[model samples]
Target chain A: MTGRTRRPPTGAAVLQPHITSAITEAVLDELAERGYGRLSMEGVARRAGVGKSALYRRWPCKQDMVLAVLSQMSVPLAEFPDTGSLRGDLIAGLGAVHDWLTHPRFVLILPDLTAEAARNPALAEAIQATIGTPRRQLASAALHRAVERGELPAGLNLELALDLIAAPIHWRLNVRRAPIEPGYLEALADHLMRALGATERH
Target chain B: MTGRTRRPPTGAAVLQPHITSAITEAVLDELAERGYGRLSMEGVARRAGVGKSALYRRWPCKQDMVLAVLSQMSVPLAEFPDTGSLRGDLIAGLGAVHDWLTHPRFVLILPDLTAEAARNPALAEAIQATIGTPRRQLASAALHRAVERGELPAGLNLELALDLIAAPIHWRLNVRRAPIEPGYLEALADHLMRALGATERH
Candidate 1:
């Protein structure tokens, strides 16, 4: 694999705010190894080889730190594989969701982010910037495709259909706490298609 | 509204395990008041009006102490509503979910609990016990009811069906990190009924 080479060094490293990205990756590894509750600023600082003061200067605390970790883990909705059909687009979109959220690191990190968001609006904004944008975009895309194809009737409340497809999958992982599997994707797709007035012939 | 009346205490004031329960409740309240990142055991003990020694005698560290706080908030699955008919019953089950999980205290508390659980098995187990049991009971009840009602195809995979209804919902709150609204409940109930090869017609 080719790696990007940087230009010759300038006066001082700008720190580009990307140092947190690398440090956060190390923190995620530390989390997988040590677990979220057990993770510490001292431990992450040591593991990332950055001074704890540098870490705190940016994060202020672990909640902000953890949200940064989660921000990177979210997949963008625009990344959906497009092949020109609503059925094709949806299966790919839901399938991507299946792959992204079910990972162990995500499951662990997200709850902390949500908890932090409940108290800290700044951290919540970061979370929204990274994760929520993608989630909403995907839903909007699917609904737009349906309307364009005349599959969904005019004035058919697209947001509600979006909720139908996504909300069930989310409910399972968060409240019901069940395993994500292939059958679930199929079921959700099947139900959502019918609700959107799309036929299963695809 | 009737209130629970407390009986007069017996003469001797001996230490008991209930103090652990009381302390855990206090910590949970503090967690809601102040975000988990700001949570400190000394603060907890101060709020609990207990000596630090008393708190330390129980859990070895902050992780274990928070784990105790989470463990108490869990509700038993035995309360899964048994109202007749799959749609009615599932809605009731969902309502039970809303009552415990979406309740003001729990909505904030759960994200922290889940974050803690994702990295810790014992904590995951404790969280899952509160989460999984109810879904299992609801799914099992629905499957059995369907079979008895001749609504489901014979020899259907009840477990997969359960996961279908379940996993999506789980991610909605924890991953998408949104609240479950009334319309969400209705769509889920309607979709689950039809997907399992039953009638959505009331």
Candidate 2:
């Protein structure tokens, strides 16, 4: 047992880059087809055209492999443009999120993470760290820009501002189980900008 | 061809009432015990101490059984009170919903329902008809009462008002994977009421 104990990351630790990337792709595809509950290491190995022993040589279990796959999905901040307007920035960010939400792999992955989270509260933090924090920060930055430009209220709250822009798309996908049509997106962006727009005579 | 085409509302249909209650209890316990998919129809039947045939007789499948359980969770509305003020009425009504959202079942059920909704859009409608419509109407009536009392603008957009309140709960439960904590709910209700609140300035 002592032989396999872990230590803090060292400057010279060897990483198995090829196997991990190949396995990650295979696992994602398997999740899209079979969903989380039915996914097995054997299935992933078979699909990746590798032996079971080869997979076990890398990750100890399904959760570890899954985390490796999910961690690869870095939120690309480059896509979030600074269009010199808060609403424009928000619209771009929200629109990019639309693709991720509707991906077949996501539909399968999210439920399992949350279902596992009920028992392991720590996993909730993991999910937030991986996906939620970056998302809110991106929106918050755009809102801050708006506040600085005097486009919003004097006492406008940042967290609440993020929530305001974020909640609608979240609702559209999660609850409605429908796409936010372009028409609705236009309406939502227009309405939210107007709502947050300050009174002219104030 | 018509020999056994019809359901007795008895074989599976007749036994539905008994198993419906049993399944509801089973799901709650199983969510605690086994998470979701580890929950098998055979398992619920075995635990309920009934034959698998009996469960099959009542529910065509697991989805059907879950749908019945969800319909029963009326979750005690906070009695959208007549506080005689727009802010008061909106806050109280939203506050009540916020409390109901704290239940663990909402987290488990909402994602399950949403996943199923992706497969069966008709089930989505059934869920809405059984649950969502009434929930919306309940909040809408409270807001409508505010309009009637001359406390809010008479033309306050009802659908938008419902979205303002309802969307946040779904957002927190589904995306944030965070509990709809009271402070967040209060803040949401306060800020939303201000944003969507009917104008009184003449």
Q: For model 2, how does the per-residue alpha-carbon lDDT over B1-202 read when each residue is reduced to its tens digit?
A: 2455556665453544556677678766665466444678888877877788877777778766765666566424646777777667767877776656556666565665565565567777777777777777777778887777765677676655666676766666655666655476667656665556565533
Clashing pairs in 2: B9-B14, B10-B14, B12-B57, B12-B58
Interface RMSD of each: 3.8, 3.0
lDDT of 2 by residue, A73-174 (tens): 635531467887766766776676665566667765665555555446666677677667876776667777777877777677555556666677656665
| Candidate 1 residue lDDT tens string, B1-202 | 1377555488754445667767887788877777455688899888888888878888788767775565445445325465667777767766555565655666677666656555556656655664466446655765687678776667665765665554445445544556676687777766566556665555
> What is the C-alpha local distance difference test score of each model?
0.64, 0.66
DockQ of each: 0.29, 0.28
The C-alpha TM-scores of every prediction are 0.67, 0.75
Which residue runs of candidate 1 sit more than 4 Å off their true CA positions?
Answer: A1-73, A102-107, A152-157, A163-184, A195-197, B1-83, B129-131, B151-157, B160-182, B200-202
Q: Residue B41 in model 1: shift from native, Å?
A: 10
* Model 1 quality (TM-score): 0.67
